[model samples]
Target: MPSRGSATTAVSGLVALAIAVGVVAMLSIGVGSRFIPPDSVLSALFSPGGGFYDNVIWELRIPRTVAGLVIGAALGLSGAVMQGLTRNPIADPGILGVHAGAAFGVVVAIYVFGLLDFRAHVGFAFAGAALVSAAVWLVGSRGRDGATPVKLALAGAAISAFIGSATSLVLYADSTAFDEFRFWSVGSLAGAKADLLLAAAPFLAGGALLAFGVIRGLNALSMGADVARSLGQRVRLVRGAAALAVVLLSGTAVAAVGPIGFVGLTVPHVARALAGPDHRRVLPYSALLGPLVLLGADIVGRVVAIPSEVQVGAITAAVGAPVFIWFVRRRTVREL
Candidate 1:
């Protein structure tokens, strides 16, 4: 058990992160292509009467910031859960094929159903992510080891490759499909809206609950499956629930922002480093840390190009890849 001082420190860190998230969210709202003064931004927020700044704040920045908040939290928390479940320091949500599955689902929606509406893609994304994740678990858990880390990684890789190739094949011939898919595939919060948030709310909420529920199980499981079972942790059930949570979180994030990698892959490492191995602390820290990085990246994307903005996905990847490499190459990485 943590000492009183340690517990207070953890709570303090969380509160600080929460405050940072608020600050960055406000920055995201204020520092877009056309900068709105802070006073006007506040006025729009406190009271709105259908003015220019009101429209930008309400329609554009608010939804985008909200999307950043939710998606960042989901990716961060989901990544932490994945790492905990797999007992791998580098595990991420995409290792379960969720991202590839969601991407393929979007492609199918555009190619087969001819439904180009972004909202129309959500159900298919959920279906694809769920089915592929289920398949990964089944295939990976085959024979003796039963969902061992290597097996799950290999299975996810194989399935992701096959699905990615199939998606490319569909897009190769259809220029129209490619045109529609290109915008989404890049991953940006520019298109986020209130309706999209409403569509994703249930899944996000469900995944967060499930992730939090498995905290104790993850702590036990980290000691090894045999030890976890002896500790009365239902290893299979915990893994299944974790996988489902990852699917829901990753699926909704992909559906919302078109597969913004690194948030789910990289943020957890930082959280674990700061919060230590106890998942109770790690998960909440991740929930806060993920959004801070993402919203910061989003703000940077908006300003770097001025009139034209880079996609948030690209910015995160550009920033995250190097940071991840540095973490891995570190002499003393934090315990998983």
Candidate 2:
């Protein structure tokens, strides 16, 4: 455990991170497609009734910025929850197959039902995520001790692979569906609608609350399940809560941004380095830092490719893969 001073420093760092994100987000809003000044960006955001900049800031940039923030926070928080539940230093929410399941749901909707609307996609995605999560949980818990973290993770991985293959087979059958899914599959914040954002909020909120509730339990559990059980914590309950939280958070993020990889895997590791391994400290820091990392990547994607913007998902994966490799090389994981 880190000292109190370290905690204080971490909190300060998070505050700094949030402020930095705000500033960078504002800069990004102003820098894109017929650049506006920073002052104008502020003016537009603050006084919506002011000028032409208001239209650009309020209509275009706000949704993208807010979506980036929400998705980033969701990924980070989901990673934190997954790691705690599994007690796996390298666990990622996507590794549970929630995203793949959601993608499959969306693919089915698109190809089978011929639904193309974002509104319809949101519902299908959530349903798919929930079903996949439940399936993984059930399979993991089938044998005996009710969802050990390792079993749960393995179930998720297996189920995810199956769903991914199903999606691929569908795509191979229908070229039209393949083209459409190709765009949505890359994970972006470009065309997010107000209704879609509203649709995702409940899951994000519910998941966040669930995660917060288990922070103390997670900290205890980290000490070892036997020790945690000795401390009167219900290991199963804690793990269940964490799993449920991951599903909501990770599912919502996938629904919002179409399974942008690596944020969940990468952000928590960054949080742990900054805030240490304590759940109480790690969770909040991950929440803040997650947005910062995501927003930074989004900004990079926007500028790196000129008029043709890069997908946020591609950007994150590009940046995250190398960092993830480094993490794997350095960390000596003791799986629970």
Candidate 3:
């Protein structure tokens, strides 16, 4: 175990890093087009109608920054919880099919039912994520011992594949659906609307709160179910609640931002590397770091292609895939 002073220092370092990243994200948000300076950006944020510059900051930069903040938090927290739940540093919400399920749900809503707007799609996507999670839990928890980490991971993979295939089939069958789904499936935060943010806020907020509650339980669970149970933690309830929170967060993020990849996978590992293994620290670190990674990527996406922005999803994949490969390669083949 690490010394107490060391742990505090580690958390302080991560907090500082996250704040620095957030500032960079803010700078990036104003760096393009009109190229507003940091002072102007601050003025815009504080006094929205101060001048023409303020309008640009309020209308353009603010939305993008807010989107980044929300989506980043969602992915980061989801990833940390997933890692803790499965005891796998490699675990992520996207890889487990929650995002795919939500994407599929939205496709079905738009294509089959013709719900063309963002507002109509959120509920469908949320329901779909909940359904996929339910399926994963049912299949994973089949045996006497309850869902082993291996079983849960495998179940998630299988379900993700099935849902992904279904999404493809739906797209291939309908050109109109393909047209709409094409951009969304890649996961960009650029097109998000204020209404979409409002719709997703409650779910995301509730999920984040619930996740924080489970930090102690997750820390105990890290020592194995028997150990956690002996310590008076209700293992099943804790795990179940965490999983529900994951569904809410990932689903809402997916609905608002599409099935963006890597935020969940990469942030948790980064958080743990910085904050140590305790879930108390890990969860908060992931929440902060997740947004930093995402917003940084978003800024990169904006600048990389100039007028033609690279999608945030694509940028994350480009960056995350190699890191994910490294994570897997470095990880020992333990149960989680």
Q: Could you report the Cα RMSD, in angstroms, for every candidate shown? A: 2.0, 2.1, 2.4
lDDT-best of 1 and 2 = 1
Q: Estimate the TM-score of every prediction.
A: 0.95, 0.94, 0.92
Better of 2 and 3 by TM-score: 2
Candidate 3 to truth, TM: 0.92
Q: How close is candidate 1 to the true structure, as a TM-score?
A: 0.95
The number of the candidate with the highest TM-score is 1
Clashing pairs in 1: 141-147
| lDDT tens per residue, model 3, 1-336 | 866437668667776977786686777668765678777777766766756587666666778788888889888999889889888877877545687788888889988899777668778887888788788888887887676678888898898889989989989999888887776778887777676788789999999999999998898889999999999998888988888888888888887788788889888887776566888787888888888888888888888988778988999999989877787677722333
* Best first by lDDT, ranked: 1, 2, 3
In candidate 2, the residue pairs with backbone N, CA or C atoms under 3 Å apart (3 or more residues apart, or in different chains) clash, namely none
Write down the lDDT of every candidate, Cα atoms only. 0.88, 0.83, 0.81
In model 1, the worst 10-residue window by lDDT is: 327-336
Candidate 2: C-alpha RMSD after superposition: 2.1
Candidate 3 has an lDDT of: 0.81
Off by over 4 Å in 1: 1-5, 50-52
Q: For candidate 2, lDDT tens digit of each residue in 157-219?
A: 899999989999999999988988887788888887666788789889999999999998899
Query: For residues 241-300, what per-residue lDDT tens digits would candidate 1 score against the true structure?
Result: 988888888888887888787888788888777777889998999999989999999999
